[model samples]
Target: MRAVVLETAGPAPHLRDAVLPDPQPAPDEALLRVTACGFSHHDALIMEGTLRRGVTLPRVPGHEVTGVVCGVGDGVPASLIGTEAVVVPGDIGHRRDGGFAEMLTAPVASLVPLPQGMAATGGALLASPIGVALRALEACGVAGGETLVVTGASGGVGAHAAQAAHAMGASVIGITGSPEKAQRLEGKPWLDAVLLDDEPWEEVVAALTGDMGADVALDTTGTSLGRLAAAMRHGGRIALVGQTSPDAAPFAPAEAIFRELTLVGSLGVERRHVERALSLVAGGQVTPLVHEELPLSVESVTRAYRAVKRREVLGRVVLRPVGF
Candidate 1:
């Protein structure tokens, strides 16, 4: 197996390709022949040594993995062989060896089979940000005919949240910092409006909702909690889904109490959420935005990490193994 290993963590981490023995599945695990893996900000944080708690050194860091099941160990069904699957990179990339290689192992319970002919590139993104978005929308309890505000709507998770909320019959408002990005979000049929982050977003939302305020808000930027609360109707729900900001947003407890607003913090998603997200992608109800596809190698992997670190890449950046 060829893998990229981060032998040490620092402000500048080193990556090298090493040939190692192929991983064998545990009794309850499946061996995956990695087809595509997506680079995430989590990977960049690990490389920069900004996120090192519970991290094991000399790691292969890639969690957004999509691949085929080549073999299954004991307690697994043989029928899974040759089936295309997406592995929920459950702490695999962060705490253990992950799918930055030609092969990796995942628990059978963590593998979601892909619909026939569905691209693994999309599958690679389904279980993470996509699933997270679904969970956040659910937490917000977005309903038909309601107004849903999606902060950081041009981002990976935010875009999917907007699409999901729109599909659920909510009128979606997207908030983005870049006008060009907002234009792209506006072009989507699912979005009802796009607001620049620098604008008076609360006033805009109030006007859009006819002064009633938005019914639900998904804050992907993490810096908009206060703004989300302000733009939301009384008894509305706000789902906090990201930590992009280094500092927490100032909260007005009295306002939250007076309005009876519900603030929910959403973290990782469950397996069922991943399954639903995958079905949506497989059915073409929502498309995960893919920025670029690069072949898996030391150079490509390093470049992808750099792009993610610089926050220059839009959508998911996928890496295909050599043969793929």
Candidate 2:
């Protein structure tokens, strides 16, 4: 089958095509005919050599995928064949060929059945970003009536995190770098307010929270928005998820210590968190924030990677293996 292979990693991904051997599923795995895959900003970071580790050259870089089961390995349940499922981009994407192909293999444990009405594009995103959002909220221990701030609030993880935090009864303050994003989040039930990163953060935070700081802040941009640190109340918790800003610095040790703030770093979601994200989407309590869809082809993959590198899109960008 044809797959978009990354020939090299540099400032941008080098995407090309190659005819290769079909993937063979392991005993506990399933072979999926990928229908959709989510292109992440992290993919660009991986390509640029900034986010090191996990990626192997001549690779297919896609983790958030959704597809139908076409085959199953020994000891796997035969009933899964023909079922629509979400492919969890486990650590395998960085090590193995991922969903940028017509077919991909994943452990049965990593597949989540699509909810009755969830589209493949939406299902694809639920696997990674949504799972991360759920885990971030869990780590921060956000509660009802509390005020939470979400950075990069228009991106996939940030959007989902804001919605999830709202579902958990917290009032969400969304922060984004664009005016369009600020307008997008305004008046949304999930977000009590939206602030532009260009504004003075102290004024923005003070205006949003009535002079008090947020009870919790989830920084998805990974920028040195020290204003985010300043916007937190003493003893509040902060969860660092991504580093969108190349210049982001470590938190001031003194501030964190003196304020008794909790700063935590979150990695990929665990099995249970993935399950919870799926359940939330299945229940219609949360929606996947998809920005655009491109065909699953070498050219489109390259374009998508470049778009992400340029920060030109919002939410999740999906590639459709099959025409949608």
Candidate 3:
């Protein structure tokens, strides 16, 4: 098997490919032939040492995994063999070997069967941008006829959140720091409006909502909470995700108290969320936002990481063990 590992993680990290023997599955696990895996901004953060907890050096860092089961260990079902599925990340990518290799093993219980016709690239993101976005939406109690704001709208979770919110009959305002991203979101049917992050986005959100303010917000950029709260209607809910932004978002405790806003921190996807993501993809409610797919290699992974760090990627950059 060929695998990519983070040989060193620091300000200037080192990553390279290696030739290794295929891993054998545990008694309760299944061995999969890797298909597609997403290169998440989370992966980039680990690579840059911005996030170090639970990560070990010389590790395989891809968690957004999808593959075909080729063999099952003792006590596992043979029916699982040849089943296409997505690995629900627990210890796989963060604490153990992951999908960067052409083959990897995962607990059979952690695999979610992929729906027919969902491409491997899209399946790879079921547990990530799609599922994570849905989880955030659920946290915020998104509903039809409501106004919703999606921060970092061009990125994976934000983009999918905007789409799912729109599909649920909400009016979505997608805000992005890049004008290029604003332009990109404008052409999509998911968003009612697109606002540049440089603009007074709060004012725009207020104006767009006719001063009633957004009924709910999906805060992908964990920075700038005070402004986010200001744009929300009193009693509105805000679902805050990971630290996607470099700068800190100034928070106002008084404002949140006075507004009686509900703030919930959302992270990681459940098995149910992954299933819902599959349903959404099957129904065309949400398009898997794959920026591009690169073949598994050291140079390809490096290029994808650079693109993610620059915020140049719209959605996710996926990698395939085999060329498409």
Best by lDDT: 3
Candidate that scores best on TM-score: 3
Off by over 4 Å in 3: none
* Tens-digit per-residue lDDT, 1-324, candidate 3: 899989888778898888888889989999999999999888888888888778887888799999999999999989889999999888766788888889899999999998777799999999997898999999889999999988888998999999889899999998888888777778799899998877898998888888988899988888768888999899999999868757888898887888899999998889899999889889999889899999999888899999988889999999999752
Which order, best to worst by lDDT? 3, 1, 2
Q: Write the per-residue lDDT of candidate 2 for residues 7-40, one digit (tens) a residue.
A: 8888755778777788999999999999889989
Give TM per candidate: 0.94, 0.95, 0.97
Give the alpha-carbon lDDT of every model: 0.84, 0.83, 0.89
Which candidate would rank higher by lDDT, 1 or 3? 3
Where model 2 places Cα greater than 4 Å from the true spot, the runs are: none
Query: What are the clash counts of all predictions, listed in order?
Result: 0, 1, 2
By TM-score, highest first, what's the ranking? 3, 2, 1
lDDT of 1 by residue, 1-324 (tens): 889888887877888888889999999999999998988777777877877767898898888898899999999999989988887667887777888899999999998888888888888989877888898888878899999998888777888888888878899999888877776667798789999988898999999999999888899877878878888888989888876657988778876787799999887778888999988887778898888999888788789878766656667788888853
Question: Candidate 1 — worst ten consecutive residues by lDDT sum?
Answer: 307-316
Q: After superposition, how far is residue 14 of candidate 1 from its true place, in Å?
A: 2.6
